[model samples]
Target: MMAPEDAALNGHETDKISVLIIDDDSQVCRFLSKIFTGMGYSVSHELTLTQGISHIFSGRVDILFLDVNLPDGNGLEAINTIRHHPSPPEIIVITADDNVDGAEIAMKSKAWDYIAKTGSSKNFRFALERAVEYRRQKKASLSRNDIRREGIVGESRGILKCLEKVAVAAHSDIPVLVTGETGTGKELFSRAIHACSPRCSEPFVVVDCAALPEHLVESTIFGHTRGAFTGADRDRTGLMKIADRGTLFLDEVGELPLEIQKKFLRAIQEKKFRPLGSKTEIHSNFRLICATHRDLEDLIKKEKFREDLFYRIVSLTLHLPPLKDRGEDVAGLALNHMKNQHGANLKNGCIMSRPFMEELQIYDWPGNVRELFNTLDRVCAEAGEGATLFPHHLPEHIRAFNIRHRYAVRQTETPDPETGSFEGPLVPSEPLPPFKDHMEKNKAEYLGHLVAVTQGDIKACCRISGLSRGHLYRLMQQYDIKNNADS
Candidate 1:
């Protein structure tokens, strides 16, 4: 038996290993439950995808046996969210479909195993035992490896998953491709990887492909001889040479010129390049890391980017979620920013009001973390010597946007007096409800419709509603609404 503290450090909470079976088939659940029980493990089962997710969030679940098709939604779609769980379980995708595509998806999603539900009982048990053994070894490894996150904030599941991947990338020399929307901290992750890698002490060179002058792009990366070009007054070392035995981070690699892309691909593949006007080739050894906000696949389809270069850079991929999708991480990010920007103010007892934090959480930050920090800086300046921050401290545009969205939601929910239906225009004679009461009613109705439309898929609900998982769960509990519309 593992100590509680040790288990927690390994992302588990229970002394004994726990397993969860999330399949609607009663016979399947009973069968799996017995197998787990016989292995001296605790087991639980949920008949719907929604309940299964709820159970995972509410307690400790070390291993999950997930079904592809469920009563509420497709279980495969929930793998991303489950992988981000605070104490993520090792997922074993169990399905009767036996579709080749589904198996590919499950493996890509990082599921421990993908096996047909119709497989023999012995096969099933073998999978479980192997998965459990892997978990044990992984936990032991995790208990000893503490990641050093440089200036990265938020302990939300999304951020945690990213950090876990960062730790994995740090130990390898593999080329890494980090993708995310603008302002989502792609460069920060790249730097973190470099900082944790074996070459941490070496120089970490950066080449801003988007900022390089078109004519000088080649000489800038591969160096230039004294007489290479008109302006080549003296010998100049390129970024590639400077990054030798270190890390070479290509920021916004998508912006590389087509000709430059061809040269860069060869340089990376061979670790040797000929500087301009030089008859001999120079050798440089460096680890590669790239960051991009654009869809390289689409770029490849459009022929704007080379297909070979795309594959060459993405040996490992890490995606950073948008701030809006991070849920409660906003609070931690805000606090961390405040401490760095206004440490003295914090020491003086300045605090954020609940309404202020709620307003922050409700707004969809288009600029992500960078925008949030900028907004907070402005708010702190405006607060001056105030003891606490309030909703009024927020930028006017943010407040205005929330007001308009709320009103729009209300209008969408308003009904026609005569027809008593939402499809018709509201009657002028009807009185408007109190602001608080109207908002409360509309919130419930909106959530209900959201669940119905998304068919109880939590991922869809989050995307559609722009709510974080924790925030959505809290609202569901507050309103006493089930994740499924039928409930």
Candidate 2:
């Protein structure tokens, strides 16, 4: 028998394609196992129909080489039951009985292919290959649909791991707490969770705790009766009520006031709350999803957030990894963001420079996705009729930070004896780049100075610099030089 790890790494794919053989004859099982195993399939064999059915229901097998005749029972009798399984493996029936009626019966039961044991080995090989190909195509189509339906992008391990948790969370009814830095798409993930859950058809209500005023927090959340307060002229419904039989997403949930935490806790626990100035309490059935960057544990120690409230809200948690930690995902995200032309405010068709994209990967995005998108938006606008975004198109601070970070790294690797004992990062007098890159950098600096001195007067700069309008614009594009405030 192949080791479990070896079996799992079959073929070029990370996940092995599994094949199961159901044959009472030990010699036949051994003969078929060699062929399937040699073809890079994880193979298993059982001697009886019951054992084969048990293996099939375990869901590990992708394709089954089922023998119609078994010692304990006939495999043809259980074909319908196996075919109807939720994740049934494709079946290829093989038997020496050479019974035409049995082949017809297997086909009617949805067996992928039927073969006679007396058939040539070549024909059997072709049948097994077709069965595996069918399984692969089916799995690929389902995987693609799953990726799109999730609305989450990125191939980083962190993102893939988070998505696994999201899928698991969707099956159960529990409070989910999403904790991440601002702009890490907490609300987006929360929406995806709701969309995948059982209550997806119902309303998905959002409550921005940070945006809610302290004075109106109670009335806004629990609602109020007619003439309850100075401005309560009519009866109003609360967000919790609107989210009944659905999901309630509380963004920046940590900003919720401490006084209201107890009331929120009780409402969550009892599923009932009394609106302001209302004589009777109303019931609401809503799934809770909360998101915040704040650490509830630290807040709990300081009494800023109630411990009971924290426990009530955090039945499960998902933390989004910061952009810097995602490695190649930064470049992937930058390109993907540029391709999201429909929702973007900036014009499309502008391209990003290799150097600019490299800098994007190097810099730590403090504001995460939001900051990256904002920078790209400005770059797209400043690019004008130009095709590419260069380092000069970036905000000054980001460019400077990139250069400083690279210089610091270089200095650490090859320290100057004069500055060996440094007080802080030694700022290089000049930016270092290869010969070709340096020439472009020099041209961009000169153009930037000329633009600043001309005060963005393009015609004047063209005349003063003794260059044609076409030539100057071309240089600006080549150097990624942008003079406007948008740059």
Candidate 3:
């Protein structure tokens, strides 16, 4: 390890900047470490990508020097994960292979720099210096503007990264493309962008590309003059026109008609369009924001979308991660939703039992945030005047989904009967139990736990299980299960 010197000598800030180098090559690690240490920055090295990623999440790393090929995995692929860190470090990809394609991939993944091992030491030093400077400026800029998160929730790394992007995008007029799974709140982010932008005081127009009538799509977008069409009994304003001096958010943009893409692209480029039956063009200056759950690239490949339009709208891209990947954000989102929607109904603020939260975290929310909110709504409704929520308050389907997932995991962990080993794939040594019998056993177990948790309050049991009083009694009788409150 090289001794740290005054960073001022290198025109760097006196405060130590942390740098992580993840390269299997010992020589490369040493060389990078010496350079960073000499510049008065603290340096750490890892031999594998996994260790590097773990180190990043565990502490503050201002910059990272990543190798494309490592002992465990390719560093290039882990860029997204690193970039989504709560305080992500600027990545400078250093690879032995001077592959042009690799450089393109690195830059596309938003790496700060991509340098080949064959490059001069001066090149590496220059890259490091620039990355540090850029990060300094970026931090200063971010510290100046706080993003306005209207209805957005969660402080997860993924959400924070997107919010940072939203803050940056709001200061510009460039077109933005927000992509995520359905129910991931694309429009909410768009609205946040608009709300934070200079055009916040102006109208924020929404054009649901998917829901627009096929016949009236063009008329609705570009507007229509009186008598222009059968429904054009009078003059009408288009969404684009209505969005003048503001934002035009095209939700589900992938659903936009292919035939209209060319015209739309032209209007976006020129900021001018002629409504139907109009002889002259009208210019409507509007900031464009588009969102889609579909993969625009795949659509382009399928010839269903225009390549030009895809490039035009995606000047800046923000990807919202699925809820399952957001980790503990699920609990925050649930509690927030409960407070906003059901706080008044309960005398005390609604609280979620630990088991209730665990069940929520385990289930993979396929529908993302929208689905999670809907599930919470149902739970609140079922919970009624209850101040606290339990796993039993969840709908039967969600509860069953979590149970099924746990069962699947357990099945995979089952050891081999003869080998007594869990190393290999699970192969049944005996005939599997009947599906009906297995389900009955699970049902009995669930009901027993529910009764214990609810303490046999029949009314509570009925409310939570969504079962009629008679049904609950019949199940209790069939299973020979007795609770103190049972009639």
Compose the digit string of candidate 3's lDDT tens values, residues 263-303: 99999999999998898898999999999999889998899
Superposed model 3: Cα runs more than 4 Å off: 1-145, 342-349, 411-432, 446-457, 460-466, 478-487
lDDT of 1 at 285: 94
Q: Which ten residues in a row have the lowest lDDT in candidate 3?
A: 1-10
Alpha-carbon lDDT, every model: 0.84, 0.81, 0.85
> Mind giving the per-residue lDDT tens digits that candidate 1 earns over 152-237?
88878888778877877887897888899999999998999998889999999999988999998899999999989998999999
Taking every candidate in turn, the Cα RMSD to the unseen true structure, in Å, is 20.6, 10.1, 15.3
Best by TM-score: 3
Q: For residues 246-308, could you state the per-residue lDDT of candidate 2 as single tens digits?
A: 998889889999988889999999889999999999999999999999988888889999888
Clashing pairs in 3: none
Write down the TM-score for model 2.
0.64
**In model 2, which regions exceed 4 Å deviation?**
1-76, 82-151, 342-345, 414-487
Return the candidate ranking by TM-score, descending: 3, 2, 1
TM-score of 1: 0.59
